[model samples]
Target: MTAGVDTGGRAPGRPRSAHVDEAIIEAVLGLLAEGGSVETLSIEAIAARAGVGKATIYRRWSGKEALLVDAIASLKGPPPEPLGESVREDLIRLLSVGPKKPDERTAQIMSCLVPEVQRSPERYRLYQGLVEPRREVMRQVLRQGISSGELRADLDVEVAVAALTAPVLIQRMLRWHPGLDDESLPARVVDTLLAGLAH
Candidate 1:
């Protein structure tokens, strides 16, 4: 081979950057915070808020629904797999994994989602993909409690999850009352639920 000869001649592949991913996601949240509805949140607006080109977003996401799903999903870090050891401990860890107390700004962002979905229900079914994983995490912890004899074996997983989380959601997402977004709320919810289910 000649010295300085071209090596593999093809241009290096430029994989997408995480920073760009984060910016786009943040832009979605920002637009939601600013009262932008789902139907109105264009790729152009998101690209502008994120300070990236429209092509960059389209390369990563096919449309606004996908982008919204991803952005909402990014609001929190991934939940830890629920270890069977001490359900209380596991619950605490899971609750603490993400943003603990979503404040008014956070609540405002979430509050806008319902009306947005109502605007174009079919286009936003993608949102369901983001919710199932979180539900599964809670269910895992509940199943562990059942197997460990810490909770009633007959407990309904779906109902239990809704009960366990409803208080926080109601206070923070549904209504904006002061002092409702307490960091200790989940720990308290777990305790109250377990107390009722203890055999």
Candidate 2:
């Protein structure tokens, strides 16, 4: 739910470039894509990749774990308010969320992070901080639809939400199906499910 993080709290020094923050995050993600294991990744690697001094990174983050958290969290944008009163309209909006730019790096970061997050509590905590709130909103929207009789009275909101999200995650993120990653995909998925679930 929180977006637009506080920009203050930097180490006492000359002001840092807003671009430096981005470059450090880009470095972390880039290293992650190259399979930067704990044994291999270090402050030196990130600083070198980001084209900055170690102090520049340290100025913003206390250490690697803190830096990684900030990097992953930045990939997730602020959750948008549900756009429509109807369940179908809202589902379409929620499911189409992604970067405005055409880049594979964001997906690549997620592809790498999904499994790694499980073993690292630090990573899991940081990943969940961005994911859990958005899921809760989807659940709320489904429940409201059910109560209003827009959806099946017997519809399980939990199952519905999973049904709503799983295809996009699986095909887009897990399986890497090229055909399924189009802009129309969200609408198509929602329509298919709503036809069966809507009363």
Candidate 3:
């Protein structure tokens, strides 16, 4: 496949191929899913699975954690926008709908990353890179709902965002639940959160 080079136009070298990058990420994800800590993830295992040299992997990532973080960051896409006019509809839409499907790789990485996040505080930067941009989008919609009188004006949108996502994450990662589907999750989350936000 293609190789992954930094494409922010920072350097002049061979353009990284998307195919190679995908393969490397897929390989790293599979290893993490198999269950291992950051220290356990080795360049040899990754190179073997990805069919690339260790030097090549190092060229892209400084270490296993960096590589793993980058791999997780690649799996996510933008979240959906609010469609209906009211807060209830907006909450439901934001919670339940998205433009892309969540896959096993994402689920696995998230499962592993939770523990990593707890052990290392500095990793929030990586987590933010992977998940926060999408959160920002939802925050804007929540602000709009408040402005339109669809939601209570004083509700803390930041806390509200955590309330929306933290439960699903806990259920999936800790309680061993099958995890909520997008369709039903929104309605439940909206009902619960709106109850608290309502005057």
lDDT of 2 by residue, 1-199 (tens): 1123334346666776778888988898789877776446799999999999997777677778777766766665557579657998899888877554325666666777777788878778867777777888898888888888888888877788888888876655555677665567779889999887456
Over all chains combined, what TM-score does candidate 1 have?
0.82
| Candidate 2 lDDT for residue 161 | 83
lDDT of each: 0.72, 0.74, 0.68
Candidate whose lDDT is highest: 2
Scanning candidate 2 in windows of ten residues, the lowest lDDT window is: 1-10
lDDT of 1 by residue, 25-102 (tens): 888889888888877889999999899999888777767766776666666556467766798978766765554556
Give the root-mean-square deviation of each candidate in angstroms: 8.0, 3.4, 4.1
Clash numbers, per candidate: 0, 0, 3
Which ranges of candidate 3 are over 4 A from the true structure? 1-11, 79-90, 97-108, 175-183, 195-199
**Which should have the higher lDDT, number 1 or number 3?**
1
Candidate 2 TM-score, true structure as reference: 0.80
Winning model by TM-score: 1
Q: Deviation in angstroms for 180 in model 3?
A: 6.0
Task: Tell me the TM-score of each prediction against the true structure.
Answer: 0.82, 0.80, 0.75
